[model samples]
Target: MFLRIFNRCASTATASRPTSFTFPQRLNRSPTAILESLNSCVQTDGGNPAYIFMDDPFLIPTSGHEKRQLALSKAS
Candidate 1:
């Protein structure tokens, strides 16, 4: 059902000449590995474990409620 709607909308937006897209190789392209490579970029303030999270346990967010609250607070 969603695909039909998407195709209808996309058909109108598409050009007369259809273009082909070739995706990049994905052998070792794991999402976790990609994020792990970014660990060195995180700023460490005084080498504190909770420094990045402002020392708030709620900010660590193990549940949906905590996650939403943290997201809303940051958005404000």
Candidate 2:
């Protein structure tokens, strides 16, 4: 579902074509855009504490949420 939406949005940007995607302008390529990009990559913990702590640095409400929220709020 997410990949489909992402592809649609991305293709819309490139639909004009021949201009080429540019860094800092392209979605998910900027430093500030990374948090939004990573939000979609989160996976379920499956009841593993170690997996929650070690394997998921970007897990919301565990590690990256506070910092990501702060950064995004500050940007706005």
Candidate 3:
């Protein structure tokens, strides 16, 4: 799920030249941390995928493709 999100975001950044928002120097400073967060969210919600938007909107919104990818991942 996370890999898919990263790929989508990277692809979007490559395809669109628009300078709308500057991405962070790194998406998540630590992949382990993000994974941990996802796991915690899952545990809290009975294995549901984490939508870490309300907590950190800026971190998650730009990659619409990511959300879609995650949905697809969930569906599969």
Candidate 4:
């Protein structure tokens, strides 16, 4: 979660600040509201693992359906 910006100030006055320096980049200040955002696409699928075709009932995770949901929200 880090961004590196490399710039060469042409003069000493530019490097030294008399006023506050705003970051040339913006950071995502919002923490994930849920743990599902970090998981793979499959984990968030909302389906019954028990009745599903999968053999190991617990092999697949059935949780939040927000994997692509978040992407669409960001687009708007």
Clashes of each: 0, 0, 0, 0
On lDDT, the leading prediction is 1
1-76, model 1: which lDDT tens digit per residue? 9999999988888856569878888586676876777886776576443333455765586666766786778779
Give a tens-digit lDDT track for model 2, residues 49-71: 44224434554344567656655
Better lDDT candidate (1, 3)? 1
Clashing pairs in 1: none
Give lDDT tens digits, candidate 3, residues 1-76.
9999999999999988875987668564675897888787864554433564434555454466877765676679
Candidate 3 wrong stretches, greater than 4 Å? 1-21, 44-76
Candidate 1: where are CA atoms >4 Å away? 1-18, 29-32, 47-76
Worst 10 residues of 2 by lDDT: 48-57
Give model 3's TM-score versus the native structure: 0.23
The residue pairs found clashing in candidate 3 are: none
TM-score of each: 0.30, 0.22, 0.23, 0.16
The whole-model C-alpha lDDT of candidate 4 against the native structure comes to: 0.48
Q: Give me the overall lDDT of model 2.
A: 0.63
TM-score of 4: 0.16
All models, RMSD in angstroms? 14.9, 19.0, 24.0, 17.0
Better of 2 and 3 by lDDT: 3
Cα lDDT of model 4 by residue, 1-76, tens digit:
1222223433555768677767688666557634455554446446444333254544443444543454455468
What is the lDDT of every predicted structure here?
0.69, 0.63, 0.68, 0.48
lDDT of candidate 4 at residue 72, scale 0 to 100: 51
The count of residue-pair clashes in candidate 4 stands at 0
